[model samples]
Target: MDNHEFESESYEEVEEDDVGHDESPQVITIVTTLPSARSHRLRTRLSLPDSGYEIDNVQSTVSANMLKILKKTFSIPNNVFLHLSQDNDLPSFPPEDKVTFCSDFFRFGVRLPLHSFINRVLCHYKLAPSQLCPNGWRILVGTLTLFRSMYNDDHSLAEFQYLNCLKASVCSRWYYFHPRPNVSKFILDLPDNNKNWKQKWFLISGSWGGELREDGVVRSVPTHFGIPGLIFVLYVHTCSSYASLHV
Candidate 1:
């Protein structure tokens, strides 16, 4: 048989499966072209409001499929693809805030924007204030790098800079000011000393001191002691909490 005859036979064989089946139009469309009607189908499948699929169960498959679409649709470079696909731990669907942000961002794109469509995208991944650990920081850095690759225009560059500044500000506040010593321990333990010595150093440096305000706000005392002082304070606070728990 000629090449055309072989291709026609292959198409007929594929259609033969659908002959007796009662497949919905949606199923047929999803199987044919994901990008053409992606927004509606994906949103319905993901079912954000229904608590549909467990995040862990769907994350890998959803991310892989969405990344495939993004790479093809945007003609993203291989380097850019590597940057996004490297972080396998990112959620399949981002939080509502990021979903909203991305939906608005891509409103004018070819397809009708769906919040879930944007939610599946890697760039929309957001780290919670409490989740600002080493791994989370790596994700954020990777996301910023990906944005740089995706958006090369001057306007987008400014926006990228703004995002970086915002991330840095949020991280500094959570890492430095928050009372979660265990979370901050990695940085706090950097000084070359034992835990006891570190605690004593915190006491001596006046970094352990804070003042309670009328509004029930406790502000750290600014000793002008800089970064070392901050780490000492966090170390002492974490140690004290653990000690209290044991007692």
Candidate 2:
């Protein structure tokens, strides 16, 4: 189980004729371990082909019993494709190209070209890029808070307040960036506004996902490949085959 002793091949040296489009591009595989409350471990394998990448697994084929166990453990969707590189030869991809994550696991980063992926992640999650940072953080924090409140004992009011709190958190965080024209001065003139001050401004803004876009997409399209272990495996394969580019 040494990290250094991953599956790898020796460098065979790329031939002069292997430099151009006529020659097949190198194939890289990434294997990863995904943490889930369900099974003891969910191993995943990803292979990057010249055209694109595919996911697989190394353990026994995911049977009905295994899937049922997973579903009982986690409320995740049941229909998932599982493959192992050992069953089928891994695919390949050009070094210059990249793979984009269509799933919730990837916020804004691509899978290929590790450096670019890291850079994009830092910019989207950590760095303040323009005015979108506040809204982005609001969504992130609100989602986390909502998950936390899920453990609360059944109370109708508590559930309602939980949703409201999530909305409020998102709206308040965003308001720090874009402040609305206040009717505060006009509050004295309009006494009704003062009395009904606990308005649903936050709900209107935070709940409206259709009105706004998440990174230029109409919806938050998350590609659920299921296991991180598969991805980790593929990444390791890619690195291991670094010298095999010549072969």
lDDT of 1 by residue, 179-233 (tens): 1212222212222321221111100111111222335654332222111111211
Q: Positional deviation of 151 in candidate 1, in angstroms?
A: 19
lDDT of candidate model 1 versus the reference:
0.24
Model 1 Cα shift for residue 240 (angstroms): 23
Off by over 4 Å in 1: 1-63, 82-247
Give the TM-scores of the predictions, in the order they appear: 0.18, 0.20
**What is the C-alpha local distance difference test score of each model?**
0.24, 0.25
Per-residue alpha-carbon lDDT of candidate 2 for residues 127-245, written as tens digits (9 for 90 to 100): 11111223333333333344447754322222222222111122211111111133112112212112211110010011211121337644221122111111212233322343222
